[model samples]
Target: MTTKVRETQICLVVFIGLPGSGKTTLCRLLLEFLRTSCKSLSDILHHTISICYDELIPADKFRYQDESSQWKQARRGIVNYVKSLVFTLKDIEVLNMVNSLEVAVREELLKVVQNEKKTRVYIIVDDNMYYRSMRYEYYQLAKLYSFSFCQIFVQCSVSDALNRNSSREQSTAVPEEIITRMAERLEPPDRQNNPWEIFSLTVPSEKWTVAEIKKISLFLNNAAEHPVVMPERNNEMCQESRRICSTNVIHRVDIMLRKLVGDRMRERSQTSVQRDDLQELSKAFTDLRHHILEGIRTGTIIIPEDTYEAINLDQSNCGHRLQDFLNGLLTIS
Candidate 1:
């Protein structure tokens, strides 16, 4: 009698946690475990690929390394807008990059599965899946490919995360304040409410081992037998997601705007601008403060739609105003 081989298909495992929460550490350990465990599984030969969210960020004019110049130049204004709002815009860019990479990675994994015919292909996504929308993106991908998707949330206290961050090299360690805010805002996976949360594991205090890896492998093998049904987004959830996105965007814009104002104020102080003129500029900012606050509360950044031309025009006007103010103060010098 001949024995038939059981095969595991393409699957995704996403890590969710704050920076310095040991997410990357857990991923490295899990990958090592999976590679070693595959040796014992008689018919299972697993090929795994790891993708990091930080590596997806673009470095060139397109803000992404893999983009075409023509397409990038055409959408340069959008790129500038994204760059200007450095905080929340990174999240948006990373999400879109992840979505695009998922398709390509899935195709490659499927090809391997097709060729091997009896082997498992796993894609490990290492990132801070801090929001539900981020996790939902991967969940949708799983349903589209009919592949098992799992999440591992690395849980650590804020103090522990801070201490871990401090011990890291300067280049890798993010600011302590950013980590603190991320811990406060992190939205953990809820398996009961969302089907994409299959094989969810919470590694508390960063304790993980080969046993956890085997458990996840077993979970995915079991999950393959059952089809995933994504839950509908209720009105409440929709509202909450929107609220979170809007709040983050507004906060980032506010930070950028305040920094711009501070820079201009320092420039004015260094110039020969008179006290009266400085007071007038300060009053203008005071007036604009109300408008800025109003815009934030209304969940929008109001800018003229003339694209790059508008940006240049605004800069020219500001430069002219500052020059005139300084020239008017030349008598005092």
Candidate 2:
């Protein structure tokens, strides 16, 4: 008599924190623990894959301000790659361009797809996802694919992060300013506000221990066993999901507008623009941003069905609108 093979389970484990918060260290430890613990289960196979954005994207690409679009493209590529892996490995070109480590992981994933054994696949995404929008992307992906989704926030004090960063090698160490900025902007998972982030875990890095690995493993196992379920159309859950998406889009747009305003102020200051005039320009941009956000929140501004596309579209439109307003002001001045 042949034993029945259990269905394959897939989970997307996202790590969010500031750089030097021990996210990478915790990921390594968790993967090691999972692999070792799975050794005794003959009928079960556990496959853990680590996808580090730092490894996938070149470090220098992040230095230029204008490269934000490219950064988004790289992020989109990672999401697409994960989608392809979860559904079907049809993007061979993407597979070809990835590094050797990712290539090996893909090969293993392919085996799991072909094999008859009961397998549990865990894809750990290692990155400093300081924005809630960033984590929401993976949550959406998990919901779309009916895969388990969980976030691990490796919390560390700014002082601790700085000390740890200082101890690192020159090439590997992140700049102090960058770490400080990230810590300030870091939006750790809030399960109360964001219902979708309920599966998240916040681990204080300083208090982390070998015992924590067992706890993490158990959490991951539970997540895998219960994947995200897609909400029915026109239901309260669906409406709430839309609200969350809109909130994320608004937050992202707010960040973009602030950056644009700051950049413009800096440029005008260096071009002999009067101090009063610069203040006026800043005020105009701030007011316009507030108006735009209010319109979005009040349902006066209709967001597109595709939230991601809406973000880029709205951002471009806002930039042009802001520039037009600036041009009018310059002409009047």
Best by TM-score: 2
Clashing pairs in 1: 58-63, 58-64
TM-score of each: 0.50, 0.68
State, as a TM-score between 0 and 1, how close model 1 is to the true structure: 0.50
Lowest-sum lDDT 10-residue window in model 2: 324-333
Off by over 4 Å in 1: 1-8, 39-42, 58-116, 224-333
Report per-prediction Cα RMSD to one decimal. Answer: 15.9, 9.7
CA deviation > 4 Å runs, candidate 2: 1-6, 39-43, 61-67, 89-98, 234-333
Candidate 2, 16-135: lDDT as tens digits: 987788889889888888877764345767878888887777776363222244776677778787777666422222244366877778676665666677788888999898867667
| Local distance difference test scores for all models | 0.56, 0.70
